[model samples]
Target: MASEQMPPVVTLHEEYGCGAREIGERVAASLGVEYVGRAMKSETIDEIAGDADEGGFVERFLRSFTPIPSHDANIAWALEAHADHEVADQNNRYLADLAQDGAVIHGRAGAHVLADRPATLHVKLIAPLSTRITRAATEAGITPERARHRQAREDRVRTDFCRRLYRWDPRENDRFDLVVNTASFTPEQAADLIVTTYRLHFPV
Candidate 1:
């Protein structure tokens, strides 16, 4: 394959509790490139996990278990709340900046946000709940049940944010070019596949 055809950008969105982060890292390593996550780019998670008065704070503060009437309403609320972080400008800027470079970007709607870019290979990483629970427990050094709860909390918050802001479920299938199940494949195998695909589709 020629370099011009190679994909210059790659993005992965994973379900919470999935080993997406680790796998993203490995894939970037295999490709000799960068790996980035939304957490790395924004402090929203830290603020939300802490005592900040971020947007949707009051509502989410009440209880994550409270279900919105529809996923779209929740995504709208999350976008509205995103202003609290004062990161919207930064987010757009960074998304534009990312177009100048390629990396293993983990979250913060990197795929959808950077859709204008022509060379990105979008991927979604998913795994069974059991795989996620075990991965989180082993990595976080917590019990399985506790890990499950924590994973669910994190997943819910992120999903809620996406639903409210984009009217799109993070788990939806349309946003990705390739979807990998980590439960069935080793991270290295996943990385190998991504790299191979990159070489095939993105000869740049």
Candidate 2:
């Protein structure tokens, strides 16, 4: 149990292609805690364009371009997706056990894992699909068109994982204590806002 006067812990859930990673970084920096988006992303997301030996991202399982032409193909895809989900679930459990109270954990279903902790503040980071696609494109230095393709694929897998595991709809607004629309603010500006908001709720 927490001391009654302690501030709430913070959990940041981010949509694909959003700038939540950077914002999470700045918020953690402002509040003097560890930032965590990359730890989760690098462990789960496969590096599509990098060397196999390099650890840019690890693949939980394969993703295919060939169509799921039949019922069997669909089944195979679902099994693969499930395998990945299991791996992610294990990681999330480890994350929860390792997290110190009051740490701002970004992603890795940190919100759900830390739900039992009193005064936990859950935040959702989102933007218009176009805005997020642009951000992903710029980060990858790819054309917006290609970015859209990648974003769609990422979004589908992510949505499936969350829904399958926790029955949580990432699109639902009510799940979060604070939801930030990243499209309107610069990354730095958004970060500042989050930091300010978090501080207001957790004055020391």
Candidate 3:
């Protein structure tokens, strides 16, 4: 008999305040696998375009493609459509390379990047806006009003980025193998659920 095949990549797409980072970290730790998410995505951008400031290349890239006003109120940043496409291409390449390690990738269009791969498992996490706002407020040490405002801004930016780059909404349930509402479950529970699901598909 042949040895069992290793599991495919696990990709997580989530709203800004949905606790994906926490849950993904837990899942990666439990599985003894690597966790690749925003930080990795940022590093990829810096590698491709060179560093500049705090936000740097990735920040500009996201802002350029954002359909609405960006976080920076004073400086309006915009890139040509082709430039946006190039950045997105670089992101896809980076994600593909990372997924080869059979890791849990937490966002930046990872699901779409690995969509064609046979072993890839894509998940999406969502929550009620109020719940997300409270979580964001608690995490950031900010008031609920402030957190709510920030959440709305982030939602617009992320939604617009996906729409402009991938021609699809990340919130669409059809794109994911599993959709969990973080409002109903703690991060630990969410992580356990994901791990259980993965084991069901790819047993050790």
| Candidate whose lDDT is highest | 3
Q: Write the per-residue lDDT of candidate 2 for residues 56-162, one digit (tens) a residue.
A: 11233323322233468778777656765666677676666555545677766666667666556678888998889889889878889878866765666565546
Candidate 1 residue-wise lDDT, 1-204, digit = tens: 333544367788887666777788888887766787665312345444565434454355333334344458778577446543344455657866765656778887776776656667788888888888998789777789878766656676666666654556877878788888888888888888887887787664
Residue 133, model 3: Cα distance from true site in angstroms: 0.7
The local distance difference test score of each candidate is: 0.68, 0.66, 0.73
**Tens digit per residue, CA lDDT, model 3, 2-81:** 11365457899888678888899998888777988764332244354443533234455554444434456443334345
Candidate 2 Cα errors over 4 Å, as ranges: 1-8, 38-89
In candidate 3, clashing pairs total: 0
Rank by TM-score, descending? 3, 1, 2
Worst 10 residues of 1 by lDDT: 61-70
Enumerate clash totals for all models, in the order shown. Answer: 13, 0, 0
- Native-referenced Cα lDDT, model 3: 0.73
Which pairs clash in model 3?
A: none
Least accurate stretch of 10 residues (summed lDDT) in model 2?
Answer: 53-62
Ranking by lDDT: 3, 1, 2
